[model samples]
Target: MGKSRVHWLRFLRLTSSFRRCPLSKRSLIIASVCVFHLLLVVSHFGYSQHQLERGIDEDKYRNARGFYNLDISDALSDSDLQTGASFVVPTRSNVVYITLKSKRLKPAHIRGTIRPKLRRKVRRKETNSAFTQYKLVTLERDAGQNKRNFASKTSLGETRDVYYKSLDITYISPTDTRIDSHISSIRIYSQRAPPWLSPKDVEVMRFLADANVLRIKEVSHGDSPTLLVFEGKTSVPKKNRKHTVCGGQCGVINIPVDTSEVFAFHLDRVLGLNRTLPAVSRKFSFLHDGQPCPVVSWDASLYPEGLAAGLSTVRLTWGEYQNSLKQRCWHKNISPKPDSGCFTVHHYEWSKLALFDFLLQIHNRLDHSCCGFRPRQEDVCVELGHHAQCGDPNHIQLTNIIHRDHNPRHLVFTNNKGFFDRNEDNLDFRLLEGIKELPEQAVSVLKSKRLREKLLQSLFLDQTYWESQGGRQGIDKLIDVIERRAMVLLTYINAHGIKVITMHV
Candidate 1:
């Protein structure tokens, strides 16, 4: 109030002084006083508006930080502020905070007497039901459990009350038998045989499945596979009796874990590579605890010098093998000179063997020392220190380069212990070394992307094998590995410009 009085007194004094001046000067002074009062009013109004806006902003900031209790100034480092970095601050009023409390409820315990409800029997007209009634029958017996139960029964034999339930047998009438026979005939006519298997292969598979085992003999060479000698059927005449030690229909049974032989045979037939022998999965009641074993058709020609003498393998070093590849031995019926290190095998055979081995990753034949792949500590090459001998690759002796006594020009893929576990990155390209061409049919199958389908159809023929391998799901996993390897092989062929030719020879 005092300050306002002082300003009023000073204004009156100035007006009095101006009144004493000339008329024109008085008019100018009045105009100037009016402009000063207007400027003061505008400045006061602007200051009030600025104070109101700042209060509104502070209120909003407090409301936003109430729940999180976050200080924007502290949240950002001094460096960030100095650099003028802009950040968005959430100011939505609809954000709700909720607190959840969980409590465990104790179970209530109540004691009470219970009485059984009696069910009254009711008689009604018989109605046909869609569900068929089946009696449970045990397929396999637990030997230990049965023995224990038998012992318990014998101990309480005299004291226990003997109760015998009458056996209920419903004999089927002749009409039912006739209907069943008709149904079975229809089923047999409707079901088609596997298209991939030949008549001879089917016959051999059946013989391996049903032929009675005469004896089990272990081979002296290779992995020492057990030889199952079966009694030949009277209907079929034996041809290679004198050649084989078994003198009858025989099967080479490998360990139960060697399921690759079966897969190798199926792949062989599917790709039309018929290099591998026909093999089937069979369970021998007296062998390997009755586990399913891969049984390959026994070929006595593989051992012409008898059981003591191992498989008739080609004696060739790595250097000689490479030289033979360059020479293209026995190609176009052109004989190679003795000086030209050429084996009996044709040049095209190497291509087929390389493709087959690459798909299956069978390193026993070409890369026995595992030169082209990273060998694990447990691998045969690593265990035997063969991997260390890879430095002298030229002198490395090739193992399992097998050929039949009668057919020396071709190779029979025996001991086909293929590895499905090997990864694509670790593939042994050494098997494909010096291989300039591949079989057209095999390459086509791989390119067509029907390898998995063909293998499925071919492998499903053996029921024992199908069930032992956990059915389609398990078999598909194995095929997936092969399919991936096939892709890698196809890529390799394209990159290397390997020729694809008809290998019908």
Candidate 2:
């Protein structure tokens, strides 16, 4: 009976096991699937975020260049310029003054006619022929503030394809990118890019330019009570009377440089970077009262994206435009080697700027006993005057006047007899040979104006009063008054052994 009972129980158990439902197994499977999907979603979001940052990093890395990028420059329309406005922006680009100290080099001069490249003969235009206009941008910083003061904002930009012939020179480029050899720290402050352009686009464009100054030195020594200068090139040990820009890779921006003063960029200001890209470099420096007043210091915030952050990549690509001037005039393969030099408002630069071609014209003049007019080159080259110890100590001499540009650069020399004075835009009306004559009253006015200008520069520098008064009309009138009587006054200054154009700003 016991054995029979055990068999019956076993048969019942087997039936129960078979009856267990598949629904329970399905529920377990569903739970597992939900967990796997949740984990995948989280992983995907994390990965997507990482990828985005990587892309941005790649962008910044590739676009890192040695110079500052980002600006608030406006492209002035013809109407705007015609209206006597420099640009469309209501305010000027935010400019900062950077005071840098190095050897103040002399400027070069051309001993020839100012206009070297004669205008091309006019030709009929084809509809398809494209014309281009090239222009350079410029900025001026205060003369006194080096690392001593910083400008809050800077404004700078470009005007390209401003002139046209057969080609559509009227068309501004879709992309406006600019690079220059030298720049005032104030101008870079204005280079911040607009939101429309990508964060790295402006920076990338800057990196692509060949315009650069070698990190020449990164340290310097200055007079007592003077703050030290930050340098960009040399890594050597400290030395007395040495100057440097701190060998930085040029990726930092808006760094609160400890001090401030006024600074000018020789490498850029005179070159077409502020006017037209003449291909290479023209740089100079100014010394006031045998000493420099301010030293230009760099700020990181004013530069484009990565540059102000102290990134390392600082290489520029030399585009075809860089050598355009050279290719036109020079055959570098010439026998004694082609002489290429820089022309500027410095005494030392003249050595490089003067050419045998110009000297030969000066030396090889023919008799002008009877002629319609002697060639200006042979007949007109005269000594305007000499600059001896005007601004320099220990006797640095610079002879200023109009002469010739022997090289392809066509530099100008001899203007109103002062070194560092350029007569490019009729700005230096100091040349009074044009005025027929000067009345005694005009001479008196000239004397008073010069005396007042020299004595009251502080009044002229009063921005609040001047800006409130309005455009340079007052100064203009004074300039006109001086110009009319300049012949006699200039003669007087020359006779007094005073280099009028070489006065300290």
Candidate 3:
């Protein structure tokens, strides 16, 4: 009340003073202007005081609520990359930010651009004959619980022919400390079969080495002279195809081993076995942090059983085979005999394989050792021979060689390395000692001029491949050895009076 009274008295005094002095028009106008300016200042002070009471301070919430100029590069680190995490990716030019809403119930919103490093060119269909190229280029939840691995899905429209080694990806989420967090674990996963592969059993393998797929699934390491097998896959043509289909040999790869494996397949095909795994020579390369690394690979197939297992399945060492043969006696009254029941059972099939090994100069197999065999059929073996051994239990007749092939006589030939290393003069014939008959069809094919031509052509298919592995000259020697060996086998059969097993193919 006192303050109000004092303000009223002061106003009245001011009015009285003005009334006494303002006899002219100019003085009265000046007094009115001063009073209006004083009222305006008072109203501004009241507005400021009201704001202070409501606690509206922008500086206090500046850190928690504001736009950020962060790019994807700023958020990601070396650990975020799957393959070439050590590589330095270029920074993205796009902008991203986070927004902190004022309402207590409303959560913070985040937004960002996803820019991955360009690994390969995605070809864009062009109207002109010239091709146009487009570059097509994931996340973390926990230290251990949240693995940042990623796989390609057709739903994402990532089905491109070119493969990507690494991707630069950025994302934003409420769980992130900053609105924009770099996802270091971005990876591309896909599976595709190579175009050149023809076997229906292994056609799916082409995508295993597709340039666009990720290759970190299951890398195998073996004890041989440093073999690194990389497991890979490419996207299937069908959009809805599952990415996790069993890859078998179609999705597996290795360095030096594949070279040998593919060569062996060629050998098998030329020899008319048609039992070896399918494989094709392929040149593989990739970029690591922008550096190029090229490799030669043989994309081989994984079948009902691989060549390694097939070569040794039901096989026994030569000594073991000899001992087992000695244990089998056909008659109760007769002494145990080595050739009684065992010799006639696998003679034909073993003879064929012996010839095959001799031609390739593959010396790893021996009589005491049975190198390969098919799955056992007890009824089939016992019916064929009462005392047949598991490795070579049945005679493969020329008329029906393929009918009961699943039995022990199948003898899948595999791992055919060691071409020109062993001395050809002292070629091992222990595997041929039991030969009593030969397949006439196989023998005729072997003696045919076409066989020689096929062998020559097959050996020449990978001239560059053998040369790279220090075996081009060895391949030439191999051809010479094959021709000479074929003639020797025919001569031996004629001299020994071995009967021909005639099968009409």
Candidate 4:
């Protein structure tokens, strides 16, 4: 109270002094003092407001950071639970504390939560939308209709299994019942094994299909397909093994776009020709961006003269080839004279090759000059000017006429690049120009109307090829082409009066 009284007396004295001065000067001083006091009061209020705002902003920032820390803590807790480890998070002021806890994860829970999601994603990637939609519709239909008819029809479990099998999304182990019991090494991916495949063929196919590829290199010569060396045990006996690379197991990898080799292999088998190497469609992740490629069993015997010499090809001009076919060299175990201009290949081999090439339109061996058919500009014969050389029928040389070194009498069909795109009007008659006979077995197959069924059954063995060619519908179209060609061939045989002889050799 005394302090307040003293301040009031001092203020009164100051006012009295101001009153003693001139009236105008005193009023000016009083107005200046009032303005200065008002400015001071305004500055004090603004400072207080700024401090309050700063406190609120700091609180808000702290809350945001607290939420961020909580999220990190949750992630850490998940990691800890997965790894069965503990973590310590430092405490901070104005931040909520998150407790770290560890829990054991059950195998069933993990699989149930993660496997289905992963499987679904993979299924989507592997299949198109149309296929998935079809499967879904099938499942819905089966469930709706089969529920009441289960007693008379197939069981519900079997119906569900069929749909699941069609998806082909389930994982199959290497050792499964799909593999043939006698030939354990070979895996049969389809529903049934192809009866045409022998045990030795199955073994070689298994090596080509599933063996680990060690290295890939060109066949040591220009204008040759790539060869893939596989690291595994081959089915060949050690005494008969002649190949030095890849421990005698190797495969010729055809390009992704060149699927004719696979078709030719199946055709050869179905016709009972048994000349083409075992070829199966497989995918190499390292090559062609994982597209399906035709892998053919490689026979080192084809390169007995070494890889630099290329295939054991029979060097014969067109006239010479036709002349040798007419001479019927080495028929019935009779050898040819030195001046006969006949090669080591037997007579029946040409007949078989002619019939085979005519059906498949493989001109690389018999008609390298595109003389038999109207070739497009993109064809190798036209692009490389081979078609122009057809003028000199006596000089034009045959190419890709390969045979094994040890067995020159029997031809081994390599580079079986058949064409299904050729129309009936443009059939290659030149291939069968000099042929006088066709294999009885092969002609019988053509005569029978069961060609489609046999081809389907044989081709279904290679699941990769079956699916790669757009499944059953696409495969049926290819068969339809062959069937048309077969009809044409049969008509030609009847018109030419070619003998359908049994070629046991």
- In lDDT terms, which candidate is top? 4
Stretches > 4 Å off in candidate 4: 1-192, 222-228, 233-244
Task: Return the clash pairs for model 4, or none.
Answer: none
Q: What is the number of residue pairs that collide in model 2?
A: 98
Instruction: Give TM-scores for every candidate, taking all chains together and pairing residue i with residue i.
Output: 0.60, 0.19, 0.40, 0.62
Q: 268-342 in candidate 2: lDDT tens per residue?
A: 121111111111111111111111122232322222222222212112112211222233222232322244331
- Model 1: residues >4 Å from true position, as ranges? 1-195, 221-244
In angstroms, the error of model 3 at 102 is 87
Clashes within 3 Å, all models in order: 0, 98, 26, 0
Q: Give Cα-based local distance difference scores for all models.
A: 0.68, 0.27, 0.40, 0.69
Error of 3 at 424 (Å): 3.2
Candidate 3 lDDT at 125 equals 32
Q: lDDT tens string, model 3, 135-178?
A: 10111112112111212211221222221233221221221211
Model 2, position 173, has a per-residue lDDT of 23
Candidate 1 clashes between residue pairs 3 or more apart in a chain or in different chains: none
Top TM-score model: 4
| Model 3 stretches astray by more than 4 angstroms | 1-213, 216-228, 232-260, 286-312, 315-348, 367-409, 459-477, 502-505
